[model samples]
Target chain A: MPLRLACQAMGTRFELVLAGQSEDQLRAVGELALEEIQIAHGRWNAFANDSVLSHLARCAGGPPVTLDPETFDLLQTCVRVAKQSRGFFNPLLGPLLHKLGLRDETKLDPAEDLGTLLDVRGLVLDPKGHSAQLTRPGMQLDLGAIAKGAALDLAARVLVDEGVTCALLHGGTSTALALDPPPGKDAWQVVIGPEKHAPRAHLAHSALSVSAANSRRGSLPRGDHSHILDPHRSRGTRHLQAAAVVAPSAATADAWSTALVAGCLPSDPPQGLGLLTQTTSDSWLLAPGRPSCFHIEPCTTTTPPLTAAPF
Target chain B: MHDNHSSPDRRTVLMAGAGGAATQILPDFLAARPHLGADLRVGLVGVGRQGRAILAELGKFDEVTLVAYCDTDERRLGSAARRAKGAKGYATQDAMLAAHPNLDALLIATPTHLHRAPCEGGLAAAKHIYCESPLAHSIEDCRAITAAAASAGKVFQTGYQGRANPVYKLARSFVRSGAIRDVLSMSAQSNQKNSWRTPASDPVRDKALNWRLDPEVTLGLAGELGAQQFDVLHWFTSKYPVRVEASGGILAWHDGREVADTVQARLTYKDGSQLSWNATLGNTYNGTQEILMGTMGTVRLAWSHGWLFKESDAPTQGWEVYANRQQFHNDEGITLIADATKLASQGKLKKGVGLPHPGLYYGLETFFQSITQEKDVVCSAEEGLRATAIAIKVQTALTTGQAQDISEADLASK
Candidate 1:
């Protein structure tokens, strides 16, 4: 069991573990976790300003924020994964994620206009110097929410590479990834379902991720309200209990699961699957019925105030 | 690599755990395990005719200690566990591993395709992984296993013990010592009606009863017999097979097996040395021979039998065939023409002949020795991966009517 910041290796989340030679191994792994997180999360560190990617990314177009490799790699992954997933997932929602109390509490105050101009296409991918060229001037990419997943994948990879074969990476139960199946267990036993008074352990093979109204709220979605905004409505969907997604890779699972929770998607999931999803009314969908390894628990936490994620 | 190698730790686990993880790993895998000996501690996975016979042979080991027994068959697990020294039996891999944490090493007799997990899991626990043959379901699985072994720095050698035998070792030493001059093309083949079968009979029905015949299990007979044959090639040449082309069909068992009852393959190396072989489970000669053709002479070795032929310059050589493989002399009785092995320190050999021998069992001993010395096992992790790659290449060719080119890149990717 290892824990480290999964700084966008797969998606957004700091991977934390219970097993390693020490907490230092986990920390050391997190320091070098994701290629993107190195810049994206680096902003929260002592070398924040010196790292051109995150610092310049925050204030692009106004001034020619020089291109750095970190931001370059991040934008590249977003475009590639977005293309592969057919637009169901887009990192352009960073501002929207921030508004939902995800990235930073202070920046939750958008600059006058937010979603209307939010376009991932507006972010130009540059090659030579290797960095993003924000065509829309004010446009910024906030991969905080989803980057944790990419981070989980990276951290999981580190544990595997380091020699701790049986382990799980958990980011306070919100974002997580696993490396190799548990020693003798079929998969990491987890709970990703509706709340039963007490939490019970359930075993699963696929990477499991859960996002729900229990996290936070942005604006008010038509009638629903939660931290996750309806980008179009700039609000949350108080209509869902929790949306869970599983994928062979953590990034896909994290990204898709959030999309589903945000009510931005229908049931068209990915290949190699098993879905047991429930909406606000409690009516649910168990795609192809229950998976071989499935577990659910009622984990409803008051949304954490949005802040720069401590990667 | 032999499934029934003796180990004290292997025996004690049987007292508490019957058949542990092996049963649960693959519920339908089957192989006939022969009666090893007596009071044997034999926990096995894959209950095919070969696997079952292995269990019986495992019974031959002292104490009949079968710590854990796993099979795709739930019925087999229960009965085998109850029958074998009250061993703990499990139907799932987790239960088995959990039940017997001290499992010395596993006797992985699963079919050619389903051999990955047990071998990997066994090695993870630092156990003496005594797998049967062809230690992976696919090249990908084998590579993953090899990587895992390297990461863990564990002792690993597959169940290809033919070249490990003493007779083949001597043959290798002699041929390499220049007794067999500049080795050219070598042709080793098994020809019989059953060796090269007719065609498939009933594909659908066999799938339900037996999976060994299943393309998934046999991995094609090429993986089974051809796998061992390819290992012999590696032993003599110290080079990965440059390419292999194979084709076959089931003649008799076509009605019941997914895999071809008969199989044939040609392994071509960069140096122009080629080896071809055929095997069918019927009256297919049941005879095995390895011919080392060199510029100086030709050495033909039959199973347990040996012989040599020489060119004009080789007057010291006698042309005679040996009746028994063990005797010091042949029918012509001229010392069976011993080669000048005493002249050099190994690594100078050009050609060598090896067949499936108990001597291959020595590779297992070497594994334990390496473990004790904290050095690498004789058949290194990379060696196991290479052997498995060649095995997969042959299987791929048999599956697709065309030869699948396996580049080092492809092997590394797997």
Candidate 2:
């Protein structure tokens, strides 16, 4: 029997299933993976006062904050994705999100321009020193777009490094990664969403992430709007219904999926990643790049309930 | 018509403000941000879990620059060096110390039995030393390290973090001021559920990684896990236990390991006041915390959070009106917080329920403060020696299932 473990992190549930001979060993390794996720959650959560994001915010006008290799790498990836997605995957939307009622209200002055706080270039990374600094005051990093997937990727790495051959890891049910196929199965099947015609992704040594505008609605009283905002327009997208992507990296898949759904991708996504997007209410299109893993099974029966939620 | 009768008077408000200032908890660098100072070059002898944690906290201080790292494990050494940025890695403590001769301080986080060598090396290099506790696996080793530190004319701080924690410091002040009246008894526990084993690639490496399971050189759960808590109680009350009776067994992870996974020890102080300590690797109920019950009240201290529960008959202070309270069953615990005056003024007292950083951060901060500001050492080497002695006796009691009497000579460093 495959050992299963779960922990709540990043405002969602992270679960892992591992196949191994020793149950105790599997459980121990899985626990370490879960511990990694929890640590990442504590460190990356932008709202928490003790989180590293808060530390960075506190040091906005002071010296640069030295970061560990893991954190430095994560931030570097965030910046790269922000550039690649043409600012769609911005981590510096913290103050703007707060103004949009996405985060807890702070005592920020009403006259302060929220747009000035959204500049990704204001986050300076000193690669040689493995440190980072916010050049502008009041600039903060939200990291909501990719933190969960980055945590899952780290957890998956831990499981792989521990000599685990077959495992499945997911963060908030929206992003899933697989190490290898389970016994007597070709790949681990993950449904994209909770719909009869939802596409199924057969993941083997890869990851899949789904983003939907209807997943998380804005909390503001100004009618319904997606929480996944477009930095270019500073408003949530309404055209695309949902976007799902499969890639070798979970963080990359998570980032690009959000970008695609938010209409931030100028053209096609970076090569080698598969993309399946819903352009209209009933119109579904599977864009280029390795769409072999995803199947639109209309006659499928017995829903496994391993569907990804809007994240 | 409103009830102005319940409003606080001018004298009461002024006294309340004075009471917050008198605690002197707001000045620490953790609550108020730290200021820039001359850089202090530092090196670490071990790149294990604790060492990595220390390095992370050290990075928070702009004045502290990580110079080098030393570890025998190639994987850990490389990983730690990569994360440190601009720091070199060495295969031995001697190599790192010799290469970084200008280093202002050295932190040691090697295994319990392996601390003496690195400590002696750092001391010989004339570097301020911060060694993790329980100082060493043997009493003789602890004495040797302490004696070396005594003559080194350098700051030698033991990593017993309770002395440096801000919340713990605030609570200690309450105890010292007789706020809790006469102390009657104390209890502390560290409960966590894990195998206490690290996964290694091979058997040879596995033996080295699983040092906690080696009975010959390893102090059982009582010594390794309870030493810090024992030190907390000693620091708070300014007293040490003279006798310890303990019992233990391997309740979980019975994989041919002789070290106990669970232990319970009862320590008798000179005043007949006792400390009950329980530690286990099989359960994580209530996590880790210390409780001191006095004649009038009780102070419960977790690592990052602390609380003081006062008796109804206990005289309430003016600051009690401003304190943040959390209910625990039928009892109420007043949150023990640093920067109470500042937070209360901002009307953010509820946000001060716990520390903004882990206890380890304050301990490392204290080490740097001692190095740069010439501040007094928080946990001195001699104090660490005494705490280790108590822990060793408790471990012996656990092993023999008998009461072990602690002699003053056992705690002497000379």
Top candidate on DockQ is 2
Question: Which residue pairs collide, candidate 2?
Answer: none
- Per-residue error for B209 in candidate 2, Å, reads 0.6
Q: Report the C-alpha lDDT of model 2 over B44-139, residue by residue, as the tens digit.
A: 888987887787777787778789999999878877866677889999988887777899889999999999999988998899999998999999
Q: Where does candidate 2 chain B have its weakest 10-residue lDDT segment? A: B1-10
Each model's total of backbone clashes? 96, 0
TM-score of chain B of each: 0.69, 0.93
Error of 1 at B101 (Å): 1.3
| Weakest 10 consecutive residues of candidate 2 chain A by summed lDDT | A302-311
**Residue-wise C-alpha lDDT for candidate 2, range A1-311, written one tens digit per residue:** 88887877888989898996487678767887887888788789886766788778866756688887778888998889888888878888877776666776455667767677788888889988788988866788988748888898889988887888788888878889888888888888888656777678889889888887767653532453577777777777665777778889888888888888777752647777888777665555678445457886552322223463211
Candidate 1 off by > 4 Å = A1-311, B1-43, B56-66, B78-83, B190-209, B250-258, B315-376, B411-414
The true-versus-predicted C-alpha distance at residue B301 of model 2, in Å, is: 1.8
